[model samples]
Target chain A: MGEFELIRRYFASAACAAGAEGVALGIGDDCALLAPAPGEQLAVSTDTLVAGVHFPEVCDPFLLGQRALAVSASDLAAMGATPLAFTLALTLPTADAAWLEGFARGLNRMAHNCGLALVGGDTTRGPLSMTVTVFGRVPAGQALTRAGAQVGDLLCVGGVVGEAGGALELVLGRQQVAAEIAEPLLARYWSPQPQLAFGQALRGKATAALDVSDGLLADCGHISRASGVALVIESERLPASAALETLLGAERALQQKLGAGDDYVLAFTLPPRHLAELQAQWPQMAVVGRAEAGEGVRVLDARGQDITPRQGGYLHFME
Target chain B: MGEFELIRRYFASAACAAGAEGVALGIGDDCALLAPAPGEQLAVSTDTLVAGVHFPEVCDPFLLGQRALAVSASDLAAMGATPLAFTLALTLPTADAAWLEGFARGLNRMAHNCGLALVGGDTTRGPLSMTVTVFGRVPAGQALTRAGAQVGDLLCVGGVVGEAGGALELVLGRQQVAAEIAEPLLARYWSPQPQLAFGQALRGKATAALDVSDGLLADCGHISRASGVALVIESERLPASAALETLLGAERALQQKLGAGDDYVLAFTLPPRHLAELQAQWPQMAVVGRAEAGEGVRVLDARGQDITPRQGGYLHFME
Candidate 1:
């Protein structure tokens, strides 16, 4: 198909314009034009997912598209920014019309769900890879950072974690699980909903915040190292899904939750005094642990014994 | 090395302060925050260059760094926008410290030259590739568009074309050329100067503008087909450089200039009446052709014979 036809068919849709407030020129132009809000600052992040490296080569393209955008948007969520616009650079080995349609459908579905618009990008010939650069807007002094955790703050995470990594294990044939349990696990692996609303909710209240991309323990360690405060994530308090428990078992689920990656859940640190207020308004959030007065991250079992893994989580390059 | 320390050494040098119209947050964070100018809109574009696809695998990494940023920034110039910042997604086979040093050095040098900051980026392990998403500010309704060219507008280009493609041929060992000529050609391939100033100058003057990326014939064809007007470029007046002529022979240079790609120079259309005014103010610009009442792009010889090539220029997927 011609470039014009491709832009019209796959790239132009209402779903691509959901959160594009400042986008003056969207998909039809040589470049996308966006006017940022007068008082708000823009937040930008880019991530690339390769066919075999980041996702399975034969996985659902729709789910892959959704997860790719979600992972990149999670970075924006981590900074307490509201999602706005994103550009997708799609490189393919060959142009398969059916593949394009399916991929775009998945991307559009997720784009609508997450409230982000597709702006401008390039399509090229290469091995299958998707690079999404997402933009967001946050107020001047309120963006959450990795370097803001206070010594005595409460460490929190939204919703459940470890399901995604556990799901990936099932897909890789490292574990065998029934469809009843496997469905939700696969969904978690494919469709991570970045905690946009919760992150925005924690803009001023959360001292340090980040998305749990590389597992709770590893990502929490990033905050600890950045802020020079010790963090304790209690294994007993960690949330577990029925799917995670079925596939990974209780103990293994806890281990995966502590050491696996691609959860995309929001992990934040708040002052202990604000815990009552946070819980009053948000029931989904749980104070699973606390930030202590030193450095590094610690994981404690039900009886307060150390259960921290020697290697915190996936060291991306090392893996 | 630690992830944070590696980031500090290789990525942090590319960071810049957002200044008085301050950034809510800058580098070393999950994402960077940027405040858009009061009455301005942000123009955004994304492009990815992959090893053994976009460029030769053994080509200089420093040049790859410069060319990658230049090519992506050219999209902003084409839209007549002033660049502000960029985000990079860097994927590599391994964490080659020396390679990263050179790449970052080249990127930092080009960032300084273009007056853009490295806002945020993700570094991961994969096949070597880089995806850079650039942002620029332009006044509402004033940015040049490719669909605005009217019949009879003069087609002009900012600089010489074909040098980059010519350099590629040499790099691929298909052409034997002197180093003196090859050095400049290679430099042109490695580091394309995005004609931002010239593009901005044509904001109100030119009816339509875009960078000659794929090639003059192909890119001008974009304007011609989009605007429903035929663009006729004269062979003699196609802004052939002395260096190019000396290297490729005059006839070969003319052919290369017609179909060569990656010359990140502005190609625009303006009314003939504004020609004198444009030339008086912007002497570097060469009025090489004219847009007509018909469709498609055509080249005119000394006797004004139509000399359009069978193939216009490079198409990413096809090539």
Candidate 2:
């Protein structure tokens, strides 16, 4: 079989999903067809991961595949859209069957978790890279956007932060940590669990929502700017991971928590009235701060004093 | 502003288009939203072009940008879907403001021409590469796929072929063509004009359709296998560009037309009764062959004898 036919044979079953109601057609076509339900809109996002840049050059292909899909699906989660389908454009330096099998295994695992079906894509020969564009369906006018935060809205995060960045330091050999601690951190970095369910649940509850990929501080700025309000983020309530705190000290963990990227956790705003109910439903959700009537983002210490850092998150091409 | 913000600024206005009616959101969010009209389904496709592989390491960024969108948009055309939105995932070695400006200019030109809005994407640091995922809308059950060809169906092409491959040979310095012949061939390679209008017109009338990216013979095989039939292609009916013939002669041009790839034209099958009307409307369209009962593909010359090449088009990771 030709390269295209080989891909079709291998990925046809890989694209099958129990939750693929939105996919009218999958794989082996010029374009895959998707039918959104009545009064629903399609939400789409694209993310590319390159070798030696998004991850280590010689890292496990399985992890790379999982991480690629997770990052793209996180955008769908942030938008409160029901997972539907995704297209993967993979560039390989060589056609290694073993590598492809491992990658497909990881991709299938993540697809199963996210309820996303692989619909269309092409595999080409180039420097190793993978670009996944995920699609989801959301009711018209109900998509969680960055422009909905209001004054007095409560700021919350789905989970802890800085674990990925701390793990990245260890993987890059810039830091040392015991294997016991490093294992979970690296897993968090390599295979993040996107808050798809929490995001879907927050649809009617969240005033604004976004996945914290570019650190809490920077991503919070997105909500602030888009909503034309200011975010008051409390450092004490930043929800730093225990692994990060143990690897780096508490003070350094705070720095990483506020400045690192690739968290893929949901950060959203809820009304004061809905806070208790949501918190009761999701015990791990952390109330980090509140939205105020202002512009930009303000970082507050435990004493409620301004202590914003100079840099917020990792900016590609610039950093 | 950071890289993402910079991209937003550079491409926001560029994304504006006449055919953006289906795009509910264009860029700047976690995911761009698209709401197709009721009774319409979305057609999605993804294609990636890598530097030194898809193109030279240092070609004009403007052409690279144009080619990227054109190639992807062609898939939408093949599905008979109206242009809607596209997401770009660009990876570059470094951030060059001038290069970005030129690239955006070219991208904007094609977006306007194709009526495709740039809904979303992100840029990362890596070897130069671009992945564009295009979305379009087609009425339910009206999409022309490769699995609909039948016996006696006339195989046709929307335009001439092999111009791009011949141009590729020139660009790679494997063949030398004079400026008069070289310019048009190179233009075909660098900036293919997708047959969007023709494709849309063929929607309900054609039995099966696909954009000819992998040359006529190879792409013809796709329709044959998918439809569980056979195709009899007349070599004499193959559309060869005047520039290609002038540069490589009749025999060599036929080889290039039959075996070379990168021609973003449309190859499709239609009933014999509808042939005259379509041919009258599109003067460039060529009735090249016929679908028959059997399997695989058979090539015939003017004398109606089998002379199929041992190979078809370029296969990535192999050639």
Report the C-alpha lDDT of model 1 over B1-319, residue by residue, as the tens digit: 5444565678666775445233445666678777776788888888889888888888777777788889888888899888888888887888887888888888888888887788777777677888898888888889898888998788998878878877777778887877788889878888899888778878888999988877888888889877889999998887767667877788788877988887888899998888887788778789899988998988989898987788877776553
Q: Indicate the worst ten consecutive residues by lDDT in candidate 2 chain B.
A: B11-20
Q: Every model's DockQ, to 2 decimals?
A: 0.62, 0.75
Candidate models: Cα lDDT each:
0.81, 0.88
Clashing pairs in 2: B27-B119
How many residue pairs clash in each candidate at the backbone level?
Answer: 3, 1
Write model 2 residue lDDT over B1-319, tens digit each, in one string: 4766768766765664224688787777899999999999999999999889889998888898889999999999899999988988999888888898888888889988998888889898899999999989999899989999999999998989888888998889998867999999999998999899999999888999998887778899999998998998998998767899999889878877877778789999999999888889999999899999999988898999898998888777664
Write down the worst ten-residue block by lDDT for model 1 chain A.
Answer: A11-20
lDDT of 1 at A288: 91
